[model samples]
Target: MQLLIVTAHPETQSFNFAMRERAATVAARVGAGLSFSDLYQQGFAPTPGRADFQDFPATQSFDLAQAQKAHQQHGGFALDIQAEQEKLEQADAVILQFPLWWGGYPAVLKGWIERVLSYGFAYGRDKTLPAKKVLLAVTTGGIADEQDAQRSQARLQAMADDVFGYMGWRILGLHLVHGPADLDAEQRAEALNSYAERLRLWLSEAVPLAA
Candidate 1:
């Protein structure tokens, strides 16, 4: 099996970094090959421009044929879009790992998605990519206890559904291990163990992790 991991942490020392490490380690142990895209370290640009939409064939609407023609034009937009598409094609599973910032994904990661998951690709709906293979491996500094409160749980679940589920990816699960700012040794171990176990379970089961 092959897994694609896209990480959006700006710092190498962050818990988001550790989550990628743990995920890669577990996947390797299970005989899964890995490919990673580190957005911040690679300095991926998120801002979209006319060039991103350039060579976009004149069409009545955003349709598959227009997108295909645009993709055929080899240039800045096509190159970057092809790179992401290649990664997605090469992997059996895709994992997005990022720290939850301001109750959502980092802007860089969001930009990567916007740039890469173009029309006629990830979700043209009619031309959508196969959804079951994609999953998420998210890390957050917020404590799990905080997520357990009724309002917080509802909000987070909605976030997950809208981001992953709505986008057609089956959310494998979230690694919302908490307190990076104040983690004790025990807490750290507990978090690692939980992450590893969940990783194993996801690999073992063929079913989607979302409800």
Candidate 2:
């Protein structure tokens, strides 16, 4: 499988990065192609601006929709967005690993979705890049109860419809690690090992991207 892991966290040595590393290791062990983006390290912009689009109309008010449409016709976006688009287009499945910030995505990850998953490139009436297979691996400081798990799935499902087409993005799994900071070294190691094992299984079971 061709896999892309999008990770967002400020600290380079955080447990979130550990989880990402474990995931990457598993993918390599399984002989699956791997790609990843560390959004924070990239200094990613969470908000879109005039600079994000090329050949877009010059107006006092910048309309993102118009700029995105222009790019589809003209065949270009900013270098960063273009790079992400290229990786996403080639992936068979996506694994998003991030800490839940305020019960949702970190600001940078939210921005990554908005800018990278642009109109006409990720979605539109005429053309859409649909990711049919997906997985979410989330870490949280607070303890995650059953309700937390349900809510996370609901949120992901909504994103699936909005971005990946109606019920198109099938979540192969959700790996939620609760209170990683409280865990001992052995516990953390066990979590990473378990994650790697589960990830290997999920990749094997993952459905291929739609043709």
Who wins the lDDT comparison?
A: 2
Predicted structure 1: lDDT: 0.69
Q: Candidate 2, residues 18-124: lDDT per residue as tens digits?
A: 99998888787777798989999999888987778765557658788777877877876888888998899889888888988886789999899889877777666
The C-alpha TM-scores of every prediction are 0.80, 0.87
- For candidate 1, the TM-score is 0.80
Could you tell me which residue pairs clash in candidate 2? Answer: none
Error of 2 at 208 (Å): 12
Clashing pairs in 1: none
